[model samples]
Target chain A: MNKSDNNFLGRWLANDLSEKEKKEFENTPEYLAYKDILKGVDKFERPVFDIEANLQKQKEYNQTYLKNVSKGSKVIKLRPWLYAAAAVFLVLIGLRTVFFNTTTINTNFAETKTWTLPDNSIVTLNAKSTIEYNDRSFTNDRSITLDGEAFFDVAKGSQFTVKTKNGAIKVLGTEFNVYSRNTTIEVQCYEGKVSVNNGKNQAILTPGKGVTSIDKSALNSVEIKESEPGWMQQKSTFNQVSLGRLIAELERQYDITIEKGDVDTDRLFSGFFTHTDLNTALKTCFEPMNINYIFKSSKTIELKNR
Target chain B: MPEQQVSVCDESIYDQLYREHAEKICYYLYYKYGDMEKAQDIVQDSFAKLWMNCSKIIFGAAKSFLYKIANNASINEAIHQKTVLKYKSTPQKTYTNESPEFQMEEKEFMDKLNQAISGLKEGQREVFLLNRIEKKTYKEIAEMLGISVKAVEKRMHLALVTLRKKIGKI
Candidate 1:
């Protein structure tokens, strides 16, 4: 709607016109057309947004966002220069690129490696673990079939899933560690929300909450304190886990064969081991049980009663 | 600090910020940049940036951070085009009583008005539509654009003037 006095029109649009100005403006022929124009424009349909869907896709963009706001007042604490850090991080991004095919990466005994997924999500496999994904469709369907144990730092994108023989852990974007071997599957969510589903059991896990299923019977909620897996920090921790399973982990980690000499392998052990030192690991694992370990050979350890 | 500071990392607080500002940021970019999809993408990217820098940003300054990030990203990549806005008109009761000829005349006038709106300079068009359609006050527009209220008023005045000139017979 138009009037010759555009300044008056502007004031009128702002609803700041005087009574006389309003009356005179209303009397003008252009007033109706202007009103029509304003009324017509008001009906313009904004593009429809699937807000929840958008939130799902985008809500997890925290880890690698590059720019640091230069203004100090805008930030409570400005981080130090991240460009050098970013350069180092860029090197951490795996150089292996496989598109339109399936890539199965497995670690050897006492070996672990970090592989950046097609979408830049990073997965660091624990020793003797294997992770497989279709690189072609990974951007769309981010499903990784995991064999053993792995800590995942999933990028913000589509729904990411870690399927195992026992169960599957599904998340949109977050970090979590999964231990899936034989009939035991344990998932600990370090960051964000995760939904774990075994064939007969299902549970929703928020950060620090986890679920453990042994022998495929049922799921039990496990409370944890650490923000991330202990193994990520060079320590393999256990909470009442079986001595046999713990021994298996120790073997995978140390790359050594253990001879169970009179030590009940089925006994539950509640302790941890450092990957840095084997002697320390052995003491941490077997000392509480009053068990002793003798070095049978250069690469073999024999466990026996004290 | 005696009381706890609001952390943007908290899901509930972050969700609240998203609900409050996401649409506004999207619409602002769409209005200024004239690409709905690109506006949305920039919005998502900026929010991602927000999440990335959540810890450093105080809750008080988050809104400006979002808009600034979105504005920068939108400006860098996208090119402005004719903003062909679609109006979802509610059928008016007055239209039912109007003569068929008068109804057609009204529809034709609306068509010309739509063309004029698209033909107007994009900044002025954005200001005008944000005022009329989004119901944003001149003060709010000024704050959003980091400008004086008088500048927004000028854009508003110019928008109306250009629209009037483009469709003169009205």
Candidate 2:
């Protein structure tokens, strides 16, 4: 074998080499190089998990036992708590539509509804959140005003638009989630091209691109990261996100406050979260650096030095 | 109650498939698209579509089916989200002011790597990324990309050869 082949084989040998390859690579220099690269690369383990919840969900969906049990029942009997959870989930899922159509759409704690727009677009309205569309007719020009959070799967048509208080997003047949509240408008595009315009500033977003808008101005900053929606999917991707910005996102996502005084605000973090619990998310951000958080209420959290 | 045999429809199977593969699919999507939120949203939609076509997909082939859906979703998402290209330096900045020798060495190595990777036929790069980064087994990759496992192995071998040649030590 050539030197390169020998090296490759040697490296393979070091890394739990199968019985067959070990004898051949014992004296290879190429194997040594490969070993070094493997060692270096091994240090950078890509964070991954088995996704137990998803697996369970899949098992439930695919398991013969559950299928048989649920087949005849008109309403698959679930835990009473699950009914509430499902209702909330449905509302959250539907929140995307409400944000797309009306000038001002609002839901109370007990409300969950799906709004089908003029373009046959679907959105799920969430509780205690409001969305409004600026234009009366969405046929000629599609645009809506949003105040809270919404998920959207815009029907592929000529051109669809969603306008928020801080900025307006123009898209052509894309799926995305938009959250515009508290002077920060966040747009995460899952599919299609979305143009986010805040007055004079405009950012055209492709899939896996997001822009954060401040003060109803153009996207002040743009981030490119792995494609994952925040609410529905298990994993959330964060690029080089500032501590303040991350805290704000956490607040919106979990409806909790994260006080900034105790933590170093300058540090930027890049990582992924896969169906991480709220406590886990908080801990992942705080524990490594020895920072601490104090919960003021369900709605408020303050970060302080330990 | 007598046990009733429930025939799982395509929808349930599809839902199951999505639930199974969404995480990895999302991860891949994130890397390809460069946005986590977008990846998640697209993955969910992709799975939803799979659920819509569950009956046509075989249970044994669900993993490949999900990957296909994810690939298509990412491509579609990319095409729809068009932009006027403007140069924005990636935040993962390379040192621009290093010693000339070091910089040149780094540049040369990177150029060689790029040249080697790009020189390979398109199929080779696809296979290499799928195998190396995506960590797909040869069988799964072959089935997904629609080629023989031997062909997949050949491409991978060729890719490694080119990469090693460009790096000069191999």
Candidate 3:
């Protein structure tokens, strides 16, 4: 066999040769060349576990421990650093407890409530929402179970987890927003790593990254304007967003739906709208796109292509 | 005759699984990622995830689940390391045999095989690894990757062709 035939034979022996090409490399010349190369390939036994005592010790150290400690009335004196260490220990122990002694924080319609988490993290609960967490003590791995929309300013920790109906959000300190309602769940991270896993599907969010999931499947994720988080405070910004998405946000904010023609789905709009009168916010987002909208009623609005 | 049943949710069973398969998983990982530490971490992470979701997983499907998790974890680690290296503005390091001079010939041969394997495109490399290292059937690989059986065969054919050429045999 020639050099090309020799090459084909080598590939066949390596299991890289295709079925159709196998017949071509069956000759003695190609077979001999392949056999020579195969002899040189290193053969190592697969890795096996070492039953060393040290491995067992390491495993024990990493295992989760659930402990509960009640506050005692004695005034025990201790060093400042010792106290900090104790606090950290308490947080770790507290996280091990599956059930939290929670106090519900709720907001009325059109109102918002901001509270500090046990780890000193800040959270702003939007209107008609409630957040529940243990108030007496906080843990090293802080987590909160949520039902509606809340913007979190997560305190830095070793590992933090936020549980919702769809899945759990695990982070290592970051500022973010989570809105889980009905069949839709959304997470927007301002910093650090945030992993969102719903048993089967999973996605990780980085700084300035946001992802939305519907029925446990990731729908779409995009980088938003840095000022987008300020939307809760009425300072909203958009960057190359679809008109449909913009309308949906408006509906969520003002509790009013904007009905538009099918032709306007592809229209893209970019602008900034602050927390202002609903009419002015609507005008700023619509007029530039050459679209006019009319309020059919307090809860509904209609958009027309100009 | 009844087949022996395994429980995916039992921690003891998982511990046994780890004790039994840890080394093989590590070897597979070491071949895929040349880093021993990363291989260990991925194997551990795969087991941890399995432990967390054990209840939802069927016993008979545990092995496949473990393989899937290990595959995903290794991919994620590879991607993460690449990102870290990029952000640090460092040049990519080429792979070489680190075995001592006493084992020079063996090391050289091993390095050649490693180089040839790593040189393949990402898709082809994955297909080859799954088929050869994991010893998975073509049909199983196609199902796991959500591709057609014919596509798997085609990719496998391409991979063998390229590897043979690189080794200078064909």
Candidate 4:
């Protein structure tokens, strides 16, 4: 019971006591009583856990955490390129608009874009097309320069003109499709009236009426009767169009390169094909004409005479 | 040895350590806080934190780290549950399905054991239970409580002496 004697018991339990002292301590009633208490405590169960379940939880945490880290690394890799691309784009836009507040929009191959002009005119640009206009003078001038195909729903206000290198198409509050590529230019009016002008001549186009030109020379106006272009609905429609031009259109729409391997590319082909399936489109274009085609890769194709 | 070198335990070692000490940690917190659910939650949280900083805590000292974090979590939880005090009435299960006579004797012994343990001083109670019930070594108790091994031994001795004084009367 003495405080001085308690230190011996502490050392005895820690096995620090000598063997004779342990033997002597074990014979005491107090040691036996303490052992009984410890035995009682041993009866009480220690809390347990399912190690397998907890380990499974740990494994899941690690997997999800590592996935996030990998995803974060990808984002980090893209960050610098995103900023650089944005900077280059802004610089180009600034340079283009430096003189007259021009807004230039261009779409790459296999891409389509739609934009609203400053005057609330909706313009849907086809693949590989560009439209540039003066944002500052849009309400006053209403003029746009087109390098490729675009469908326009002009807001009714003043005269609207689409100028190209080959010619220009002028309208007022009408829906129309204008296509200018290489030496060929085509303007088809869908709603109201539009006037097409080549370098040497001009023609008036009403709804379902259109005109085509080659090398600044105008062709006779023809009737189309279509409400919209096939490309707008993911279809490529050709009416007695040349194979070379059709192949060029397919290349732009599908972002692929095609080589004419000893085939008459100048032959006229007429057919329609969906844009979602490239193999079907190729079949629709070449199979009916008895031509053989081979896809060298996903991005390259070759056509030969059959 | 460099602390970093000692601390860098791979996943397998950490997993082994978790398997070895996780239940003891849970029971330790449960006895201290009197809430088995809260104790298990704190143990899980401590393991999560340990894994997050596995490279910073030495493998040899991981038990101490687990105890330190588990203790802190229990303290915070104690403060939060002060208003509830729901586990205060949680009676320990003393007997399972057994004869009425055997159950009565078991309950009486369990009541005496609980009373003797409750009669001990706080330090002695912790050291004794962690050692006798949770089966922790004196060195481990010393490291976990940030005390010397002598202190743990003294606490264990005093706890046993007190328990003997309380239970020996019967």
Candidate 5:
């Protein structure tokens, strides 16, 4: 009689009526008619359908769809500007691959690195040092460009060459140390022979022999009985190395920037400092030289004359 | 429009939706045209269209999209069949392994039911078939037909009343 009753009757025909409503509606004439219609429609059978065959057709359609997707992405034509940008990017990448085949290894802060080259030649790089070389041509050329200090144990094969801005060290197959920094070059031959070249001057060095070239003019060779450099064993050793150079090495090992205030950094320092502890490293470097040092900030250290 | 870009429905979800609705859609199409094989083809094509526009159509809206496409396609097929002007034979009775008397009663009941349904108005028949055969809810039918739920209930009530009157005579 009402809208809700009418909806109830509709739901009854749909079999959507609840149990109570269904029970109440069962006695009504409309419910009986709905039941009769339901019986009639229930006998209407569904045409037999092969669901498996339908799914198979869907699978086949999806296979072609995947093929079209892959083919679609293959030839995405961009705008002319995008094409030009892509072309330029590709050329830059090609240039990097061809000309800049150079691999440069750098150590920062208190970090030390020991790398075995492709030829099995071992090179231990001290803190703040860098060594660059063309690995692709290393087998044939066995050469490396060096900055700062590195101890090398060259593998026996061809001529091993270490080039620096200050000088060049040429050897056959040997264990040696080369320290090259601004205006100062030092080469120490530990196990084998080394030929050092600084401008027109050249010096041949044998075991326990070290050479120092200052400003491309003064060439001094000294005797060192030690088997390997101290820095290689986590200690910094210098035979008459300058305070400025030692401070620079300290900055690299501990990731600090150092500033000198009224301290003569050019003065020579001859001592060994441990690489592990920052406080101990600073004490060993400055105590003997009588230079006072303090932390300016977390990342800075200032050194002043006592 | 901006919201549709975020819900990029991947193919796996699309496949899931396909498996879930394909059977009901096939049945709905078959009920509309009374041709099972032609209905299957239309359902397949409609699902293919859904896949082609999968990225643009959000996953939640996909069911309505599928039905819309199938409905349009079925309409076109009906028009095309009408132009051909070829008379189609009534669906043949399938063989059942029951007794002869039982089969005779079933066939008689089925004939009467078909007659009752064929006598219905097109609107009422469609609403009834979607509700009973395809098993769509009244809400879903209303949504598909762009009518209110009350309209769906009214159509169903009228269709049932007409079927009762027609089949009661037999």
Candidate 6:
């Protein structure tokens, strides 16, 4: 038999070879090797499998665990799949627990609240502000979303990102204050370094450096002279900002309503207002803009152009 | 009288199928994985699995069903371990006149042959061992392995070719 014939050995093993063919094939050294190998292998004995013992074991297994797995119930056949499904469900719930635990802190009107983040960082939220952070994965990835304004004293660790409406600030470990209101985002870095992105422009700030992105114009750089934000010192400072924006900040801080009667609120006013006294606060806020304010009641004010 | 629908749920039919397929399935796993104890455990587990679903299976299909269960059970254990195949040696008559050199050569050749079989590829080894050791027909091996008779034939041919090359090297 020729080696090229793939079926030759198969046919030979099946005893399908003619006697003459077998005789010719047996003359080759290849045939002798296979014959010896087969002879040696056929003497090997397999381990005995005791059917009675195994059957008895299976019967006992069926009695205990199989629940008789037949006409009464199909639980046995369906159990592995159910367990698999249950495992998947538990895995999803586990993932949800780790990823979906969002902790939110909110401050009411005229209320300043200090919150401790999960990573031991501190966030002092200004009045009428909200901060949301993921509590579960805070250690590995430090990030939070802010609305309104807040002062963050970040702990030393990975890059901490403060996401806001108009811009975002990223820093390793630094004290920075972020304020997002209307179309402006202001970032003041008091220590370490920070990278500020206003979607349209990006800037890097060191200690005592600040950037304010108003509308779509270039970022306005300002010097932060205070060791902390002025609001933290019972005072709020504004730089070339509109009067209407000051009115909004005043209302938020004092929990009062203000009415502007025929006053061009777009006029810029640069000044500081104290939080200690309402009369001084309103006078300091509206006097420089040449706008007159009269307290209609304890919680309401009307501003008139002088 | 109702016509008989040969159900494997019947004790007699179950026993009959078990008797027929249990040994073949055990040896099938043994040849595939080279683990006798694991093969025996797999056989027992496959039989238990079969018993659990006995009421839903027909009698004629029980053989293939057992083979399929046995095959599925061995999927995670296809790692071929180097388990030396042991053969039963006939008691030698000490008075025989064969030379000691010839006897030592025979022992060496047998050891090489066993090693060669163990070193064959999983597919070729299984087919070769099942046929050579179990004396199962090519048709039976084809059905058990879920392949065509032609495929089994080609496997046997290639297996023999490989064995020749391996043993001939010495």
Q: Kindly list the per-residue Cα lDDT of model 4 for residues A1-306, writing each as its tens digit.
A: 346775566676667887887788788767777777767787766545687787778667756665665687674356878989999999998887775677899999988899999899999999999999887787798999999999999999899999999898899999999989998898888999898888799898889988878899756676785699888899877777788999999999999999988888789988787889998999998899999989899899998888
Task: Assess candidate 3 and give its lDDT.
Answer: 0.66
Candidate 6 ranges beyond 4 A from true positions: A18-20, A64-306, B1-5, B79-95
Residue A98 in model 4: lDDT? 73
Docking band of candidate 2: incorrect
Off-target runs (Cα >4 Å) in candidate 3 are: A1-101, A136-141, A225-228, A238-245, A255-272, A288-291, A296-300, A304-306, B1-170
Ten contiguous residues minimizing lDDT sum, candidate 3 chain A: A64-73
Give the distance in Å from residue A142's predicted Cα in candidate 6 to where it truly belongs.
Answer: 21
Worst 10 residues of 2 chain B by lDDT: B82-91
lDDT at A157, model 6: 91
lDDT by residue (tens digit), candidate 3, A163-219 = 899788988888888877776687888877888887678888888888877788754
Tens-place lDDT per residue, model 3, B135-155, is 677777677666776666767
RMSD of 5: 20.0
Best by DockQ: 6
The parts of candidate 5 lying over 4 Å away from their true place are A1-92, A295-299, B1-170
The TM-score, computed over Cα atoms with residue i paired to residue i, of candidate 3 is: 0.37
**Where's the lowest-lDDT run of ten residues in candidate 4 chain A?**
A69-78
DockQ winner between 2 and 6, please give it.
6
Best model number under lDDT: 6
Candidate lDDT (C-alpha), each = 0.82, 0.61, 0.66, 0.80, 0.80, 0.83
Clashing pairs in 4: none
Range of the 10 consecutive residues with the lowest summed lDDT in candidate 6 chain A:
A67-76
